[model samples]
Target: MCASFIVAAHIEQNLSIRKTAAIFSVSKSSVQKLVKQQKIEGNLEPKPRGKPRYSHLNNSTASLREIVAAHPDATLLELCELFGQNTGNWVGRTAMCNALQKLGLNRQKNSEK
Candidate 1:
């Protein structure tokens, strides 16, 4: 934690911000910014990564399930088309495939068409 370095250089050793930068191999602005963050946020650790974005197909899961259940033999592209027609929100083949997989729906053909 560079907080320790800032403490040692500025508080204990009484070094200037520029001297701390030179001694610690960090920029003076970095030290100032970190100190400012510590004062404002009351912590030195960086924020955690944000949650994943909601899927594009998130809104129409019910209609999607109805479409897939109604046409169990439809291909992914066909499912995309039907879902688009039914819900007015077009989804790509891969997105439709992924949604189907997430919903535990499979269209694995049994025999040659």
Candidate 2:
């Protein structure tokens, strides 16, 4: 942000884009982009680009942990079903597996020694 402000100030002072980039140790394209953004938004500060990500499991972590604790031998599909029954919202098998993995509760079948 400081770099952006300096770039904008230099450009406002009639400094060449190339010279501003050279002084700032940034790419010429970066200077150009910042100048363009300043022209468009009247500021060089970057704006958030996309919607924030949301997780269906955010509210179900405790329920998931309890379910896994109660059913250590449950399959991924079974866990997904149980989560749906508990939360009233069904999640995909891969999503449930990923959520479980994120919670450090990966379930794997026992292999013979």
Candidate 3:
């Protein structure tokens, strides 16, 4: 945010965009972008960056642990299917694996199943 203001001040003082970029060690596009943001948003202050990530399996951790405890030999697909049936959320294998990892559990089979 401070950098944005400093760049803008230099440009307002008649510094060329290229020179401003060189002094700031930023790209000309970056300088232009900041100036444009200042005009459009009416401030050099930062904006929130990205969308918050939400997991469908967030509400099913306890049931997941119990299911894994019961079926230690389940594959990724089987676990996802079972979890969907239990929670009615119907997520994919990757989501199931990520949820298991978040819960600090193994998503792998104990033995051949």
Candidate 4:
């Protein structure tokens, strides 16, 4: 998508790289890089786009799921604490929450009776 936007930016839309980057909330260098890549490689896939998987998380996903399944009401902080205890190193609350979300373990708000 970013590549399409960049390639079409000049003749089709007459939008500058800086303007396109600002509107897209991306770096101008990204737009320029993608434009160059499209011209050279004819492909637009983002390389190294997101966080690399943590080996700890991959190796212990089963244990983490077990802990959460045993305690569905646990808050993210609580999960992090438990994870740290199990792994001997702390997992960030954000990472824990993301993992739980991916695992279908979201904490929905409970309605009071």
- Please report the candidate that would top TM-score against the real structure: 1
User: Model 4: per-residue lDDT, tens digit, 41-95?
Assistant: 7887767878877745656779998888888788889988988898787888888
Could you report the Cα RMSD, in angstroms, for every candidate shown? 3.9, 5.7, 5.4, 8.6
lDDT digits (tens) for residues 8-81 of candidate 3: 56667888888887777778898888878777887777778999877778887889998898888889898888
Residue-wise C-alpha lDDT for candidate 2, range 1-113, written one tens digit per residue? 37566665676788988888887788889888887887788876567899986667877889889999999999889988988898898888888878888888868777899
Q: How do all the candidates rank in terms of TM-score, highest first?
A: 1, 2, 3, 4
Residues 12-113 of candidate 1 have per-residue lDDT tens digits of: 787787888777788889877776777788787876799876666877778888988899888999999998887777879888888888888877988866
Better of 2 and 4 by TM-score: 2
Q: Which scores greater on TM-score, model 3 or model 4?
A: 3
Those runs of model 1 whose alpha carbons end farther than 4 Å from true positions after fitting are: 1-20, 36-52
Best by lDDT: 2
> TM-scores across all candidates?
0.63, 0.55, 0.54, 0.49
* Residue pairs in candidate 2 whose N, alpha carbon or C atoms collide under 3 angstroms: none
* Model 2 Cα shift for residue 70 (angstroms): 1.9
Candidate 2 yields a Cα-based lDDT of 0.81
Task: Quote the positional error of residue 21 for candidate 4 in Å.
Answer: 30
In terms of lDDT, the poorest run of 10 residues in model 4 is 2-11
| Sort by lDDT, top down from the best | 2, 3, 1, 4
| lDDT against the true structure, each candidate | 0.79, 0.81, 0.80, 0.79
